[model samples]
Target: MTRRVLPYRTPSENVISAEDWHLVTPDGDIAAPEALPDWDYRMNLRLRRVVNVDLDRARTESGLPADAPLLLSAVWTATGSNLSGPAQHLRLPRAGTVPMKIDFELSGTNLGGLLLLDTALVLAERRPDARPASPRRAGSILWSDRRALRLQGDAPQFPMAVIDFSLTSFPDNAAWHLQISGSLESATMGALLLLVNERNTVTATAFANAAKPRQIDRLVLSAVYADAARLMVEHALSHEDFSEESDYPDDSLGATMLILFDRLFPDQSITDMRLRQRQSPSLFASDLQAAVTIFEVS
Candidate 1:
């Protein structure tokens, strides 16, 4: 593996040691695996890890002052949603070995695809009088590491919520609704939501067991996915601005829809599909049903 060359001195690789991340579950905490096949928007992730830093050796190797302020921090990034933010931060001891514990609670709505965890040790404050080859700038990295966890491997990979339909304008008996709002330029996470009616126990239960779905639950989920895809495609088709030539920001709603459209209608152009939908609405619906392969057994 190639290593990044820093202009300033850095500590040895052994200065910081981190344990594998643990996934906190209701039963107990377990070592996080490479992937979570059943992870969904309704599930929030709780993770924890322990790290030990040899501060004395780190400072000496990096030519930092004896009283230098160092910081240990963790940050998280979700590739699907294109969202990222700080997770945890702690001040390192001025001298001696320091042990730090990191706990991260990530919301499901803000996460999708790959979940990346970044941990780093940095100079917390600027030091102008430090040695010439020493780290002198604030936030100068001394050591860092990254870990990744795959969340899901399918479509409709958006945020979701379960609530009582009776409390809203939607029909009380509606099993679920896919809500799409905002312009295509908006972030996909903020533009789409899958709302399952809590009173619709069948639909709600299907999602609750999505991670380990039974045969019946699988059928229910497949139906839900097909319907959700239909709604998403129709919504995209309704917007004239959505086209193959249009440039959209990465992770934007328009970008997401463009990808979905390509997957659903591989060889068909947007103009042809739009014309077909307008000429024969019924036939278009059939075509979409076939495209989604609704309720097909896997």
Candidate 2:
């Protein structure tokens, strides 16, 4: 059946919370591409975030062209916890010109207005002529699994597949790691790990060619339980269509929460986890750390 389609527009409301990173300082900015402070010459800055995938549904609805070789004009903004009045919009390419990639930066500065963070991204603008870039190149990492999973009955359960991730500066713990766990109610169903970062950017997103979420397990310092829970609950159920659903906590919310809780606190068990969420995270590896372990839910 042909799904309903609508013209996409920028979302009227946004807060830059979940997927956002910290700030900038005399030393350096959190999300900026700039390196860590010399500490001798500069004081460590606060936090300046670069929300990875801006999955702004309205914009996705309005901006992207309907057919192949789609040209999408987008705005990437970096807001301060300080609440500075304006955001920096990267200069986009002119209509006819195309870069080797869509590369841009989120720069921050210190007391003297010294540059703190400068998050540079070489994103690929989806075009008929262009080949695909890995998810890490397009945006943030969700979950990456080389192996498949079969949920066993157990606690302290490892995820059948794993959701790997990171914080602002690679190699360090900008935020805590999120450990996830999921279950398959029956033999007929499929298994997935839905990772979410709502408080951040909702405008920039990259989906795999297969249309499944990519995995990014190579980043972050450590994996913890609470972070895992948050990733799961805030997630939305999605389809390639991009215009069918209303936004929110959602129908599968209770069930998703239950699955997370059961995996975290396996003393409780569930049979069904089939409501829906917003988006799915895919595979990713950090430049900082090469190998992180994947968790499975028994």
Clashes of each: 0, 62
The lDDT of model 2 is: 0.26
Clashing pairs in 1: none
Q: How accurate locally, in lDDT, is each candidate?
A: 0.88, 0.26
lDDT of 1 by residue, 25-138 (tens): 989999999999878676789999999999999999999878999999899998777789999889987899878999879988889767899989999999989899999999
Candidate 2 lDDT, tens digit per residue, 1-298?
Answer: 1222222122222311123344444565444333332321112223433332233332232243323122222223211111122223343332332232222333222111122222322223433332233121232212111111112211112212212334333233222333332332211111222232322222112211112223332111123333443444333222222121222121123333444444443442221121212121221112101121233311
How many angstroms is residue 74 displaced in model 2 relative to the true structure, after the best TM-score fit?
2.8
The reply for model 2, stretches above 4 Å from the true place, is 1-72, 75-96, 104-256, 265-298
Residue 210 displacement in candidate 2 (angstroms): 32
Candidate 1: list runs displaced more than 4 Å.
1-14, 17-52, 61-71, 88-108, 122-142, 145-152
lDDT of 1: 0.88
